[model samples]
Target: MTHGGGGALYLLLILILVSIPVTLIWLFHGQGNARKRRAIGFSQIAIFAIAIILFFSGVSYLQNIGFVAGFIVLIAMLITPVVFKNRV
Candidate 1:
């Protein structure tokens, strides 16, 4: 049940789809403190970059846990503030 190259493509698409709107909202909506917003943005980008690096660095888990599961967790991290805005 492995998607191989196609799984990577799907993960990239999901990141793009989720990132665009989230970035726009963060950039335009003044959702929180400027520093926190930027922090979250940088963290998301860093996580994504790490995932990419791991995938290309011959990491075996990339084919199994890197794409779908990783991206979903990444997306969740990206939007966690919004999901629990009142608490944060």
Candidate 2:
């Protein structure tokens, strides 16, 4: 009946997953935005989704890779809009 930090980590991932779309809508909203920019904006959602799927799967190496990838995607999420903003 005692679960340690698993629930907390799950919540963290859920927060991250939710933040991606929120950030996309908030940061990228404007007239004359390009489809390419929108694609880049939404890629974080796909990245985190795959990361979570891989992280939870049975393959140990994939889980580690996914864990690392998730963090990398988090950083990219912060940086991506800035990088792509000039094109919008």
Candidate 3:
């Protein structure tokens, strides 16, 4: 819960890691669907914010693991569309 420079940097890294794949998805599949992409992006941002808040708010270890597992599943789902573009 230290609000130091390191904490800010950690958050920035988390934001970047979460945003990169979403940005790629936005650039590719979101070609004509601006509104949809915007909504998806906002939701991702919100999810990341919630995860960080939970992390800093002294959430239990099991809950944190569950959150991370859910995040990984979400990322996998997002990547699936890109990987199998024709099917999606």
Provide the TM-score for each candidate, comma-separated. Answer: 0.60, 0.66, 0.48
Ranking by lDDT: 2, 1, 3
After best superposition, candidate 1 residue 19: deviation in angstroms? Answer: 2.4
Q: Which candidate model has the greater TM-score, 1 or 3?
A: 1
Model 2 C-alpha lDDT per residue in residues 1-88, reported as the tens digit of each score: 1256356567567758766765576456734566766676667778888998998888878877777788778767766666655656
Q: In candidate 1, what are the lDDT values of residues 1-88, reduced to their tens digit? A: 3455665677677776777577556644655566666676666667666665665555567644555555765676567657645432
Candidate with top lDDT is 2
How far in Å is the alpha carbon of 39 misplaced in model 3?
Answer: 0.7
Sort the predicted structures by TM-score, highest score first.
2, 1, 3
Of candidates 3 and 1, the better by lDDT: 1
Please report, as a residue range, the 10-residue window in candidate 3 with the lowest summed lDDT.
Answer: 79-88
Which residue pairs in model 2 clash with each other? none
**TM-score for predicted model 3 compared with the true structure:** 0.48
Residue pair clashes in candidate 3: none
User: In model 3, which regions exceed 4 Å deviation?
Assistant: 1-29, 61-70, 73-88
Which of candidates 1 and 2 reaches a greater lDDT?
2
lDDT string for model 3 (1-88, tens) is 3345345445455645765676556645565555655655556556655665655556567445545644654565366446544422
Number of backbone-clashing residue pairs for each candidate, in the order shown: 0, 0, 0
Model 2 C-alpha lDDT versus the unseen true structure: 0.69
